[model samples]
Target: MKYLILGAGPAGLTFANMLLSSGEDDFLVIEKENSAGGLCRSCMVDGSPFDIGGGHFLDVRDPDVTKFVFGFLHEDEWDRYERDSRIDLYGDIIGSPIEANIWQLPDKKQERFLHHIAEAGCNRGEPMPEKFTDWIEWKLGLAIAEDYMLPYNRKMFGEDLDSLGTYWLEKLPNVSYEETKRSCAEHRPYGTQPGHAKFFYPHSYGYGEAFIRMASALGDRIHYNEPVFSIDYDNRIVNGKYSADKIIVTIPWTGVREHIGLPGKLTDSIGKLRYSSVVIEYVPENMDTKAHWIYYPDPKLSYHRILVRHNFCPGSKGYWTETNLTRFDEDKAAEEGRTYFVNEYAYPLNTIGKQELMKELLEYTASKNIYGLGRWGEWQHYNSDVVIRRAMELSIN
Candidate 1:
């Protein structure tokens, strides 16, 4: 094979398709699982489709990226909807970013949150804190931070929220005292919409259906149930089987250490990579909620968020809960008898030195015929569109 791809996820499969589209086909896509689709894989349960890797929808932010993603499925096969995401705040349901939607809350509650926003550090011209925990307080004030941001992030990123850096916050919606107050005064949404504000989903299948179609298009070019047990990077050989001129690794760097042959220093550094894990559990929901997904910030709840699958997916009156792997209850999950999928490397953490470390490792690998791509490969918490666009760009280069 001229090229060897080490995963069948969004990054790997997209790269494979791009290669084929360019009239180049001497490549093999290897997936450790018996099937393709990687973490985005979906399964059927009593006529309902479950996204085992958690809720992944085609983001409509980038026209080019969305166009490329829409190519796999026909127009009639997909459905688009404006995002109606909600937040559960201490028994009260309101729009997300309590700062902007404070008007929806009770009069007293609205007045209190407005006061909190007024006293926020961002309004006082205070410097942003370095830690995620303190930054939350500084960015949105102590009230909203404690009420929603802090506890919700604790459920999402685990107990020591301080360990996380503030770099990733740039991607999230930024709240300011002026916009927030104006929003509350006028009862309108402020700032930008979160990802999937307007998105697409498959009509009859889960979000993974398009990737499955992409995999099917590749035919024999994809190798299933094949793990790269050992890689001879010196010779560009994989498991003593096939040799390729270049290899693209889309798996987590932490998991790839044992399978790769690298210097002790490089391998040890790879082991130090930090990431978060999540367990997705699907359950039946007879309630017909208009919201596509709801965020739970209460520390009492195990799940940080739940996707109303019935709203987006067809033929199913169910929802899926996402919990941090540390808090997931196996017994309860088994009792639910619903679908449960665990991904050990869910969100790559933006630690103190993660950027520098990834830069060094990627530079080293590129020098050798091995390259890292996508979320795990690049250790970036990128959405599907960004991952696919990166893959497409790499294929062209």
Candidate 2:
């Protein structure tokens, strides 16, 4: 084959699809699982489709992304939704980007939230902090940070917030104090919308359906149930069997480092990469809320968030919970008798030196005609749209 792509997830598949669309057909894809979609795959829980890899919806922020994805599955295959995401603040149901919906809170709480936002360093023109923990207080103020972001992040990340870097946090909602106050008075979203403010989902199937269709279109090019057992990166060889002139790896670099010979320290940094895991537990009981998802920041809660699956999954019922795989929750593991999916590699952490470390690793691999792509490959917490966009962009080049 001319090119060998590893891990048939969104990244690998998109790259291959782009190649075919451009009339280049000498590439091959190898997947570790029998099915495609990787983390985008869904499982059937009592008939309702559950995304075992956690909540994934396509963000149409980029028209090109919409065009590429819709190419595989028709536009009619999706149901568009204005994001009905909420925050569970104490016992209150606050609309997401809490600052924009504080008006829904009691008068006292509203006044207190405004006070906090008004005094936030960002509102006062102070420099943003570098550490994720410190940045929260600086951007949203101590009150909001303490009340929600900090505790919620602490639970989701299950790590010292100081260790995470701020390079990737631009994904957070960028609400200004003026827009926030206007939103409170106007009772609607205002200012820079958070990602997925309006998004699309599969009409009848889980989000994975689109990817599965894309994989099917590729036919025998996708080698399912066959994984990259080993690689000789220097020689552009996979499993000591398939050889290609160029390779794109979408798998986690942590595992790839071992098979490929690299300077020991670079390999060490790849191994030392930190990540967060998620346990997606599907509950058959439906939640009595219109929200597609709700963020629960309370450390007391067993799960950080709950997906109101029935609301978004067409005819599906029941909800699923996303819990960080921290030791705290492992000991708990929901006393209820529902089997759960444990994804050992979930969100890749952008901690401290991770960006620089991955850069060096990718640069060295490129020299050997090997490339890394997707979430684990880039070691960034990229959503599906971004992942697909990057893969397509890479393919066209």
Candidate with maximal lDDT: 2
Candidate 1 global lDDT: 0.84
Query: Can you write out model 1's per-residue Cα lDDT over 5-56, one digit (the tens) per residue?
Result: 9999999999999999999999999988888888788998658888888998
Which stretches of model 1 miss by more than 4 angstroms? 171-174, 257-261
CA-lDDT, candidates in order: 0.84, 0.85
lDDT of 1 at 114: 77
Looking at model 1, the pairs that clash are: none
lDDT by residue for model 2 over 1-397, one digit each (tens)? 8999998889999999999999989999998888999899986778878898999899978999999999988899899999999999988998887767777887788777778788888889898888898888888877789989899988888858899888777666654677767767777766555789999988888888888988988999989888676878778888888899999989887665346677788878877799888899887887889998999988889689998999998888888899887733554555655668888888887789988899998999899988889998888888989999999889877
Clashes of each: 0, 0
Cα displacement (Å) at residue 216, model 2:
1.2
